[model samples]
Target chain A: MIVTEKQQLKMLSSAEMQLLHEGSCSLLSRVGVKVTHAGIAALLLASGAQCKGDRIMLPQDMVKNALAQSARIIQFEAPDPAYSFTVNGPENQVKFGTGGQALYVVQRTSNGWVRKSAGTDDLKQIIVLCNQLKQVDFITRPVECDLPDEQKDVAKAAVFRRYCSKPINLANLVKLARLAEVLEIIGNRAHLSFIISLVSSPLVMDSSAGDKFVAIVQKDIPVAISSCPQGGSTAPFSEVGELLQLNAELLFGFVLANVVRPGAKVLYRGIPITANLYSDASPRWCQPDSIRRVALAAQLCRFYNLPCCGTAGVSDQAVPSAQGISEKVLSWVYEAACGGQYINSALGMLEQVMSVSYYQYVIDDIALGIVKEKFSKAQSLAISQLALSAALEVLGCFGIEPDEKMEAELSARIRHIENGLEPYNETYIEDQLAVIEKAVNKSSSTVFMKAARKGLREGYLYKGARLDASLDLAAVAERLESSEGLGT
Target chain B: MNKDELLEKLEHSVVMGHLDADDEGYDGSMEGTPGTLELLEQALEAGIEPQKLIESFRVAMEKVGNLFASEEYNLADMLASAECVGEAMEIIESKLQVGNSSNKGKFLIATVEGDLHDIGKNIVATMLKGAGYQVKDLGINVPAQAIMQEIREFKPDFVGLSALLTSTMIEMEHVVRLIKEDSFPDLKLFIGGAPTSQAFADKIGADHYCRDVMDAMNKLEQVSNVS
Candidate 1:
């Protein structure tokens, strides 16, 4: 899983990263994050964060101290012991895991693709299926249990304990009160971890997530303080603006994590995806624009030398197809090449985290294997070459031949990711910050969407030609049929 | 300039999504000039009729709507124009006589309990206000009790509920049930959010399921036309 320096994709130079870090610090100290939890606010205030109305502003020194005090190497222990791994901040190792809070389970039927409501049984089946998938290094709770709010945490933990042997990431705690019972059911805190979106977009902290984060960190459990800001919606439409806000939000989590428990095992999870402003403002997960921003986020996380929990391969397509496979391959390659140590949502996700398909799981396993193989065999090759080659090979395996138009589209995508769309500078960052501040102050993302009017007219989002060849899903179907515990 | 010229400027400013003299507006260079607010105030000071200003707002918003539909403007441009009309309506309402104002039907909007998402709700509220409706924005994480209380007090003709999280969808259904159980039979319930669909609306007994801001506007317009 280690990516060599030659194979690494460096989207931002050190100077650019420094500017982004400085901008993040400025945002934290200036705009600040709204902390609704009084106790957390008090804790932050006591820890050198100034109180500005409802927001708690972290100074540069405070943020730097928190960064220094955070754990550099986070050990993700698995129940099987042999599957355990450690994510070192300075290492180039990348691990892929299944992750999502998908509401539906998609399956290919004789009639068509059927999407049914995902329940606790689907959680068990997914865990069992992923346990056998060699490419799945760890297992994240992909779907929430169909239980009452109070019972969900414990019920989901029990299901993972009984079915999964890999490192278990109960993505989020539904109820903080049930944490004790959930941990007791799992029986090993070492084998367990959690993901908390402690801060909402535009620097607003979710009170419930804050409470859960405090409890989990206090328990000495490894957690990924995640922040996903959809550009043109909750964040600025520009990549620079979105990254500044995203970095600020994640840094706020790190400061709070250190405040809660010094050296708290927290990974930097920043997914700076864009909103589909051309239509419904829903999040575009694995589109080319999102792929670029997410890869940039990974690179930035590496710049901070933080344990990176990257997100990729969450396909935007509703069903598994050639376009989905191409998107997943490119996303996985770029994210891994950019130093994502512990990648999540790397398999089975579809429809922008709305659904997970069983067939898609096997397909992702194969496609990811192809990607990792390409990365490992790569020598003196740029990330763009690795991505394009891997994507073409993966698509060819899926019975998709990239026509000239599609090849040109893929080449353009690689070029775009290789060369960023926006300039990372002081003036640009300040303007982006102003847009975010406007959105936050007004409590509406219309400022961002309005700001994006020009960009949309200029094709800010990649409108590439899709690979329309019908996917030969025979291998996927065979794998799904032969896979154990899928109830197929 | 003259009153007619001032009115034309005000309308133009709204269409350009300018708020005040400080606003950069659509093209980001219109700052430090007479924007919608400044122009409206000047027109009013120059003895322009409030009804005439209202007519200008309607015309400007219609143009903005067309721009948005044609992809020349986005949600932000539309919202900016709507905000101009919304703020102008507040000023113009005071100038007009009681019950003779150009106000449309009252609309109440809120994100359901346990959900802190407000972008969708805020956009809908601003757009409704721009469309000449008297909108009451209850904001995010509003509990069912608070929403019901607001419904009773506001007596809105339409109640729009929003919840981005599936967990809060239940709360949305609960809010809808509470509203339905009340005596306000003429109140139309509209539900929206990522998880909401026509099926969910039907199951929860909501009168309509808005897919997005445009969908909400279209449904509201249909009801307005029917009434």
Candidate 2:
């Protein structure tokens, strides 16, 4: 049975939400969004938007009409039906999944945990772990594989599609050359998955992201339009101002996608990141403001009846320490309780979402189980649960004796409830770890290993082919053979 | 404000990331006060030495950099301070006579090919310029041929290559190899970036690895004294 939670926390009042939406609509109709791509600009212009060069001023009514045409509930298709889910709408449930583009992986050592650049082998391990864990509902590109700069995204998608049967959230396919291969990998499962297109915050749509977005949407695949407006840096410092800017950016994409193909399946994702005033870092999962902003984003998504996607379970701590675990759990509770339907980075992330930890993956599963259990609806009490006769017999208030068969039935039922509540303990976590270990030891999925073995060759060929130059492949192969393993 | 007061305000402006007299975006308290660039020009107009004016900007940047290191200031703060320095440098560049401060050294800097990041490169360039080095910034994604061409014409005492992307750092090796093979074989090559390390620098045959702008300046001083 799937676990679901209904949000009781209203971070924003109705009037405030209306004002925020109106402010965004004003920003759209007034300041306008900068569309860097010529084709996107033309499309918007043709669709009744006022375009002067790169800036496209979208009419408020046009935006509202576009939103009206969009799907309230879009199905997130997966390779298997078990992993399939729906996002947006009132029926959306809080689901945990892996988020991506991490450059490094954390590994345990005698001293402590050390971080190393993630490569193809780490990518495989990430997918395999996500697949083995019943907790992870879907998979995004877990870690950016250390492959040739030109082919990493395409190669990662290919490898992930082959091994992981869950739904995938494709990272921004910036390179046009890799699009065809990625599309082929997605094939008929377009509904089961979606590609992401990011907008440079403070109201700028990158031309490359724009082109890739159109390309994906044109193929009938759902697209997630995500914008991360960093407070005090990219957007306004005030929370209200930041949300307004974030909403405006997301609405711009919604209008653009709908203009291209009306009623296109789009997930309105807002990542309202907070900038650390003392540090140069844009902390992905930090304090009061980040969680508050997340809740507010969900509230806003509820206003639009769209599936809310945001970041949670992130940490500034490098390792799985008290600070990391506390921050992850806090963000998880707030995001889940406040109606975040598709919470990104909810599992297996550490170091401010820069690195993925294998151990942290198991720990997060247990944490997720606890949150689900705590937030799950209370079971209704029945006459059997009252246990009036058993209570009277135990208290010696009645002359009648308790039935042994009924007593045994109650004990069995009590045991089932106790078992359900005990998944968060260390023993259960260890069991999940052992399952992952067994899966890895089995080596049933050799696709990632195959990719790792070909890393040097593919990198060399891609770069060499670009240069129109030839290398002594035999010599390079000998060097690769003698080297230490990738992602070590 | 007096000359000393003006100079102190210049330092405060950068620390606060205030650009001009009316620049009120960051801190409202800084509004209506003369910013770094305005005070710098005022100092120059008040018969202060161009060297002294440049020194004030340098001291402000030092404070900003320290704040950055201590987590008291962020990237936006550093960037805003850099913008103030850039504006002041442009103002002071016209007043200063050439060859007055050329004795320290001359340096050419560029982000290696296929890498578009130049935040670190720009900061280093500004710091080196303030440190009395004649800096030629080739901007981002500069190919090896451009560096070679500039080297042939500019004849810099040192070349600093920056690459933020690990994949593009390979291009730095090519640049170093080509520059070493050129006629100016003694031209010192220094490398720095997010992915660059002392080990990578040594393997790429660079003369030095700069952990940050201050490190680069310290190594530059050492090179100047030795040469």
Q: Give the per-residue lDDT of model 1 (tens digit) for B1-227.
A: 99888888899999988889877788777889988878877887888888788888899999988888898776667887898888888877775543525367889999999998877887788888888898888989999999999988988999999999988999998998888788688999999999888989999999999999999999989998898
- Residue lDDT tens for model 1, A1-488: 88998887788899999999999999999989998899999999988889878978899999999999999999999999989999999999999999999999998889989989999999999999999999999999999999988889989999998989899999998889999999899998899999999998879999999999999999999999999999988899999899999999999999999998999999999999998876668888998899999999999999989999999999999999888888898899889988899999999999999999998999999999999888888766777888888888888888887787877878888876777778888999999988888888887767787778666656668877777889888998888778876784
Global lDDT scores for all candidate models? 0.89, 0.65
What global local distance difference test value does model 1 have? 0.89
For residue A292, give model 2's deviation from the true position in Å. 3.1
Report, to 2 decimal places, the DockQ of model 1. Answer: 0.51
For model 1, the stretches where C-alpha displacement exceeds 4 angstroms are B1-6, B94-102
> Taking the tens digit of each residue's C-alpha lDDT, what string does model 2 give over A346-403?
8888877678887777667765665555455332322223222222222221122335
Q: DockQ for all models, in order?
A: 0.51, 0.17
TM-scores of the candidates are: 0.96, 0.73
Clash count list over all predictions: 0, 2
Can you list the residue pairs that collide in candidate 1? none
